[model samples]
Target chain A: MDYFLELLIGGLTRGSIYALIALGYTMVYGIIELINFAHGEIYMIGAFTALIVAGVLAMSGMSGLSVLILASVVAVIYSAAYGFTVEKVAYKPLRHASRLSPLISAIGMSIFLQNYVLVAQTSDFLPFPNLLPDLPFLANYVGFIGSTEFIIIGTTAVIMVLLTLLIKFTRMGKAMRATAQDRNMAMLVGVNVNRVISNTFIIGSALAAIGGVLIASHVGRINFYIGFLAGIKAFTAAVLGGIGSIPGAVLGALVLGCTESFATGYVSSDYEDVFAFVLLIVILIIKPSGLLGHKPTQKV
Target chain B: MSTLNYTKYMEGMKQAVVVSLWFMFLTFPIMVIRVNTIENIIEWRWMNMLYIGAGSFILSFVWRKMSGRGISARKESIGAQGGRKFYLQRLVSEKRLSLPALGIVAVIALFFPFVSSIYQTNIMTTALMYVVLGLGLNIVVGQAGLLNLGYVAFYAAGAYTYALLYHHFGVGFWLALPLGALAATVLGVLLALPVLRLQGDYLAIVTLGFGEITRLVLENWNEFSYGPSGISGIPRPGLFGMEMDMHEATVYLYFLMILLCIITIFVVNRLQDSRIGRALLALREDEIACQAMGINKTMVKLTAFALGSTWAGLVGVIFAAKTTFVNPASFTFLESAMILSIVVLGGTGSIIGIIIGALLLILLPEYLRAFGDYRMLLFGIIMVIMMIFRPQGIVTGVRKTYEFHTEEK
Candidate 1:
């Protein structure tokens, strides 16, 4: 029972990170019907930004929650700027072309970013020691599950709450919803579509970066290619959650994380990939719109 | 004859001269450089000889036709002679005969053992393997309009299947090959089950995830797959009953590779004209229309996934046999991209076109061996330029029509 609980917690933590990234994919896809293939790379850039800011903070010798808070602010701002720039440069120009053009371009940007980082940082994995603790309270149950699980799940819950509040209650949130529903109507009604997209990129990227930091902190190591798979998982999470649906993304992330963790833990780990991919493909075939998404009927 | 007929004769003649000249040049260098063993120059050898022979045959035909010409301008001759026939003859321009030209090439390929060095043969073998990969992807991206971003997953699955079976179970390549294909097909079906509901961008993302997820699992799963160290020393393909290690028979092996290439070419060509291909194209153009017209889009999609993946799996088995190694790195996104590029550049849905595409794309970089680090930069620039100039591709609508006419015939 304790082991199961641990696995569940572990799953939730990973799911949280996935949920954050999934939100970006789902939102961009929801509005423009284009998969922002570069989204994962943006998450990558954010994680690196966090690394830099955290390094600066530690070097300056700031201590306690203040250090964490200050580092967090800088990381978020940096990642948001990075995300906005990525969209502006890669996506905005090809908006009028067929949907496939933007997708191809996004993939191109993704490849470019990965190679750029690999060239700049080298292809080796770097160790990132604990900027955040695993916390002792989780230790008593560590035998049952693990410390990483607690930190991830806890951070995720806090972030989710904040995100929910931001999306549901805020004026900007209302405007964002208005924009997603109908871009033309939103524009005519004086809601800035481009601004909303920029804002969406910022929020989504910040969440992914935070998730990235958590992942780095949990694992204590990362490489330039870190976001490649993680980004895909988060995208899966968004799809699982029914994309455009915020709660759905979180739900989807949790499911994917749990399913993968359990599969690794119990089933043949060698075929873990075979299982997850096959599962995703199966789900898409069965429910094309996704579990959380409503299918739109086509007009003749 | 009318003006058009006269022009045609003239154009045919010009092509004949040009083709024969090209063929002569191909052989002229050979005759001049016959000092060292024929294998000395690395690049010029039996392949060039075959090119010259084929070129000569085509050139002779053109020469014969042009000899009949009264007057000619290049453009007018092309119009008179028939553009397709001119291009076809012009393309070979060596032997000046179709069946005999082919026969000469075959005889040369057979005698390659007596001539060329081993390195050129190895490159030919590699190019043939890629021809299969290119054709498989064309089925998915070209026929079905489904963007399969993670095709390498199937390739890996196929390779690993061969390695595990042949190494551990003591299965022969023949048996292991089909089994690997089956496993990939099953996996393809399984993958299709989820993402079939998704279309366009959503489908692309899901497929991409599927690809990465497969690779990640393989990477992290240390025990069975040996983790990152990878599975090595897999078995090689064999002669009918003889072992490949018995002799330094590069030419015989090259012959076998050519046989496989021919079989692949034939199979893809047949599939391209079948009812299934038509259904796939219908789905590509308009999914709703296909559905309304009584096509079961689900089944068609699954068939695409299964067949396309099956080919990849088969190619994977061949790859495993050739390399004697299987690992996660070999089946990366770049492999998928290369295959996708081949399909796109070949003009999608074109069987022979993809062959040319694969041969050119893969061999182009090989020939530019001097460029080294700058190769990728140049390759990328070329791709961008190709897209800008000939986005419809080199072989676009030809195959579709070819399939129909063959059926009619």
Candidate 2:
């Protein structure tokens, strides 16, 4: 029972991070219908930015909590900037082109960003400073739930609620939904489609950045290549939940996280990634529309 | 008029400055600052900011000019009758020029091994392998419009099949070659069975997942795949049971690749004009319309997948023979990307374009050692720029058009 509880908490923590990244993918896909392949790169850049900020602040003798706050803020800003730039440079021009054009461009942008980081920063993995300080209240639950895991889950829950409100009640959110439903109709109805798309990228990127900071602090390591695998897994989570659906992305992420956690825990860790991919393949084969995604009718 | 021109120039310069400033800000943390967390030290490379500022300033100007020209050129092309033919396309279409060009190329290829060092011969062999791989992928992505991101999985399948066959049963290259391709074909069919219903991005991600699964399984399955330590010491291809030295073997492999490349080109060219070829093209353009026209979508997609994998499988065997080694590392997503870039850069459906793309991409990095690190960066940039400016590629594929004339009696 104790082991089960531990695995459950671990899965939730993992699921929260995946949810953060998956939101970006799902939202982008909802609006533009492109996979936004560079999104993982955005998450990676976010982590790197936080690492840099945290490292500098730590060296200057700032306290842990303050450093974490400042680092997270800067990471969010930088990631949002990058996400906006990537869409503008890569996707905006190819909007009128064939379906494959934007996808290829997105892939190109992903590669470019990865190489950009590799060239600019050292390719070796850097140690991410543990910015999450230990909470005295959580000391009794150390075995089953660490302070980092507690905070991660807490922060994620708060963010998810905030995101839900933003989407459900906000004007920009309404604009985003309108654009996603039909770009031309939204334009006719006086919604600035481009602005909505850009805002979606920004919001999604900000969420991913928060996820990046949390995961980096939790894992204690950072690398340029971290984004590729994480991105794929998050994408799987999104697909599992049914892409283009918000709550579905969260549910899918949690399910995927739990599955990975249990699979790796009971079985061997060697096939952890394989389990995720296999699950993805299985889900895709069984339910192409995803758990919550509606079946898209083909138009002539 | 001079005042107006000066004002325009000044406006452009102002925009360039803003663009450069934005770039400098964007690149500040990553490019200009390096923080050592363990050592608690900060290295601020202020010079990088200057470089980025200058680079972006110049690049923005170039970007504006190019885009301006692109819009006008597109308008002109649209206005022109019958559209403007690419020079390379014309060169290929005219037999008078193409035959001699082909003869010259053939002569150069035949004499290349003798004149060049063994190192150059090996490099050329690698380039030729890419040519075949590019052409093969062109069939699926170019003609059929199905993006198979896991194309390297089949390559890995072919390689591992040969490696395992040789490892377990002492199978020779001659036997393993056909067997490896056959194994890859079977895997392709199997993969296609599940993924045939998927289209576009969904298909891409599923294939990508499939690829990752294959690699992970290979990496973990120690007893079977040697668990990433890799299988080495595979023998090279043989000729009439004769033993050859290193240089002789290199030459042999080079010639073998050339022969295989020719055969692949021939088959792909013939396939492109065949009924199935037209079907693949139609599928790429419009899947629903094609099915509505009575074409079997499943069989066509399956054929494209199978045919494409066959070439990858063939090359995988050759790759194992050439390196005398087999490892999961050799068959990576990057390899698939490189091949896809070759197809995209060369012109998706254009054979001549792919050949040029392969040679330029593979050989340029080797020859230009100083820019080796930037090769992939350039490739990414090229892909984006090509898609934006000229999606048709360097050599556009010419479509066959028919004309009818009534008999005047």
Candidate 3:
């Protein structure tokens, strides 16, 4: 039971990070129908930004809650900028080109971003300062669950709830939904589809930034290449959840997280990535529309 | 007239501004770095960033003048004008300089090893391998219009097949080459079978996943693969019964590559006119219409996958033999991207185009090695710029005209 609980907690915490990143993927995919391959790089940049911020703050003799909030805010802003630029420069031009062109362009952008970071930052892994505050009183109640785990879960829940509310109620969300449903119809309805797309990129990137900060702090290290694997895994999570569905992304991420956790715990960790991919293939084979996605209505 | 000229200048200025802003955003992250000096100072090159922006703006202005229209206009002209003389085709058809050009190229290939240093010959050898890989990928991406993002998987499959066969089963390189290619083809067919229903982006993702899975399997199957340390000391393919030095070996490989290239081009060109090829072309244009016309979609797609993977596998064996090593690291997503870029950059479906594309993409980075770390950075940037500026590729493939077949019809 203890082992199971530990696995479950670990899975949930990891799942929350994947869920945050997956939401960015699902949202962008939902709106533009382009896999923003550079989004992973965006998360990576966010972590780097936070690392820089935390380093600067620490040198100035600041730490704990204030430093975390400030670093996260800066990281979010930087990531949002990157997201906006990537969409405009890379994706927007090829929106109507052959299907493969945008994808190729996205991959190019991803490579460019990766190399950009490699040139700018050290290739070696740099330790990230743990920003989660330790509160001793809650230790008894939440036994094996670390403060970092709680923070990650809490942050994800709060963000997911807020995002749900925004999507369900806000005008921007309505415009996004409308644009996603049909770009032409959305245009007719006077939704600035370009603006909506840009906003989607910004919001999605900000969310991914949060994931980056949390995962970096949790792992206690950051590197230039962390984004690539995490991005692929999160993308798998998004696809497993049904690419365009938000709730499905979260659900898929949790499932992916648990599977990865169990695979690592029971089986050899080397095969963990293989298990996720196999799961993806099996799911895609069985349900092409994914667990929550609707069967796409084909028009003659 | 004066006002119009002024308006044009203003428009050009506006474009420059926009381009400058774009560059600023793009290079923001790259221009700043944390130097690990005594104080850990943040290195931010404001002047360098601004200069790059200005340089890009000026380059765009120059490009606008050279191209003689807006960028969109260039794209429209290509789409609208189908009969524009493709240089290679026109030269060959006109029977003027093309045959001699071909002779010169062949002569150059024949004598290149002796004239250039061993290092240069080695580079050309690697470039030739890419040429073969590029041609194979062109059949799938260019001919069939299928986006395969995991092409390196087949390459890996081929490489590993040869390596395993040699290491365990004691197969000769000559015999193993065909078997390795066959293995890749089989794997390709198997991969396509599972995702038969997928289309477009979904198909792309599935292939990407499969590629990652293959890599992971290779890496993790330590009992077989030797786990990341990689298998080394595989015997090099011999020429006749001679034990050759490095230079002779490279030259031998070059000639072999040329023969393989000739075979691939001849077969692909012949296939281009075949019933199956036309069916594939039809499928690429419209899957539904092709299916309605009684074409077997699954069979056509599977054949495409098979043919493409076969070439990749052949090259894989060649690569493994040349390097005498095999590892999962060599077969990353980036390798697939490089191959795809070659196909896309060289006009898709064009044989000569693939040659040029493979040469430029492969050799450009080698030549740019002087730039050190910026070589790959430039590669990525060039790829994006190429896609944006020339989606049709450097040598836009001439649309096929079925002269002989049409006469019979």
Candidate 4:
């Protein structure tokens, strides 16, 4: 029972991170139908931004809570700016070209951003400062969960709820939905499709930034390449939940997280990555639309 | 008129401001925050950022002016001199000079090693390997219209097959090469069987996953692959137990790759003109419509995977024989991306185009080593710029049509 709970908590923590990053991927795919491959690099940049901000704060002897809050905000802003530029330079120009052009351009952008960071920062793993406030009282109540895990899960839940509310009630959310359904019709109805797409990139990238900061802090070490595998796994999670669905991405991420955690706990951890990809292939083979994805009707 | 000119000047100023803002944001983290040392000391280079911002604003302004007038002027001239434009197009396409061009190229390639240094010869050999790989990929991506992002998996399969066979059973390079290619072929067909129903992006992701799986498995299977130390001491390919020296070996491998390149080009060109090639092209353009016409999508797609993997596998064998080492590191997603870029950058489905694309891409990075660390960065930028400016590719392929004729009634 203890092992199961341990695995469950660990899985949920990791899953929340995947869920956040996957939300960015799914939202972009929903709006523009292009896998914003550089979103992973955006997540990496967010983590680095947080590292810099936290490092600066630590030098000034600021309180941990204030540093965390300020760092997250700065990271989100920086990452969102990257998302906007990537869309305009890499994607917007090739919006009407053949399907492969945008995909290749996205890959090119991903390579460029990765190397850019590698040249700008140290390629070796840098230890991320743990800024979570240590609460002695929580130790007695929570057996398996650490304060960091609690914060990560708690923050993710709050974000998810807020996101749900935003999508459910906001005018921007309705416009996003309309644009996603049909770009031409949405434009004809006076929806600013371009603005919606840009907003989607910003929101999605900001969410990815949160995921980046959380995961980097949780892992306590980060390198230039951390986002590559994380991005792939999160993309798998998004697809597993059904590519365009928001809640589905979170659900898929949780399931994937649990699978990875339990598999590492029970099986040889060497093959941990193998399991996620095999699961993807199996899921794709059996149900191509994913668990929650609706079947796309062909116009023929 | 004076007021209109002022308005134009204001618009240009607005454009420059936007471009400058974009450049600053893009270059800020990379330029300003130079995290140089292990202690994580923040090294700021504000001057570099300023230069980049200023340079981009100037370039953007110039680009705007040139495109504003140059494009329309060229279009009008081309419209006026239609016959001259057609003649120029034919010359540019190499229709008139193709035979002579082929002869010249063949002569240059054959004598290239003797004229160049041994180091250059080796680089040329590596470039030729990519030519074969590029040509193979061109068939699947350019002709069949299938997006495969995991081609390196098959390349690894071929190399490992040769390595394992030689390590365990003491097989010769000559015998193992074909067997290794066969192994890759089987892997490709087996992979295609389950995922043949998928189209476009999904297929790409699955293929990418499979490629990663191959690498991961190779990395983890310690007893078989030595787990990352890699298998070494694989014998070089030679004739009748004659172990040639390094120079001789270079020439031999060069010729072998050239032969392979020629065979690939010939086979691909012939296939493109064949019925099956037509079927593959149809599948690429519209799978449903082709299926309606009784063309078997499954069969065509399988053939594409089989033939494309065969070329990759053959090159893999050559790679192992040349390096005398086989490791999971050699086959990465980057290798797959580079090959795909060759096909995309070259006119997709253009035979001669793939060769030129492979050479430029492979050799440019080699020469750009003088540019130091910015080689790959520049390569990535070039890819994006190329896609934006010419998404069809640098060398567009010729579209061949088969006309149906009815006998006189």
For DockQ, the strongest prediction is 2
Indicate the TM-score of model 4. Answer: 0.95
Candidate that scores best on lDDT: 2
* DockQ of all predictions against the true structure, Cα-based: 0.09, 0.70, 0.56, 0.61
By DockQ, rank the candidates, best first: 2, 4, 3, 1
Name the lDDT of candidate 2. 0.90
Span of ten consecutive residues with least summed lDDT in model 1 chain B: B30-39
lDDT of model 3, residue A221: 89
B213-252 per-residue lDDT for model 3 (tens digits):
8888889899988878788888888967799987788888
Candidate 2 lDDT, tens digit per residue, B1-409?
A: 9999999899999989999999999999999899976677799999999999999999999988988987887778689944676678777878998999999999999999999999999999999999999999899999999998899998988888889999999999999999989988898889999998887777888888888888888888998899888999999999999999999999999999999999999999999999999999999989899999999999999999999999989999999999999888887777877788788878888999999989987997787667856766776787799888876677877777789999999
Residues A1-300, candidate 2: write the lDDT tens digits: 988888889899999999999999999999989888899999999999999988888788887689999999999999999999899888987788767678778878888888889888978999988888888777775656889999999999999999999999999999999999999999999999999999999999999999999999999998998998888899999999999999999999998998899898999898988899898889888988788998888888
Q: Which stretches of candidate 3 lie over 4 Å from their true place?
A: B1-30, B33-72, B75-80, B83-97, B402-409
Fraction of true contacts retained by every candidate, in order, equals 0.20, 0.70, 0.52, 0.48
The Cα local distance difference test for each model comes to 0.72, 0.90, 0.86, 0.86
Measured with C-alpha atoms, the lDDT of residue A110 in candidate 2 is: 85
Pick by TM-score: 1 or 2, better one: 2
Error of 2 at A234 (Å): 1.5
Quick one: ranking by lDDT, best first? 2, 3, 4, 1
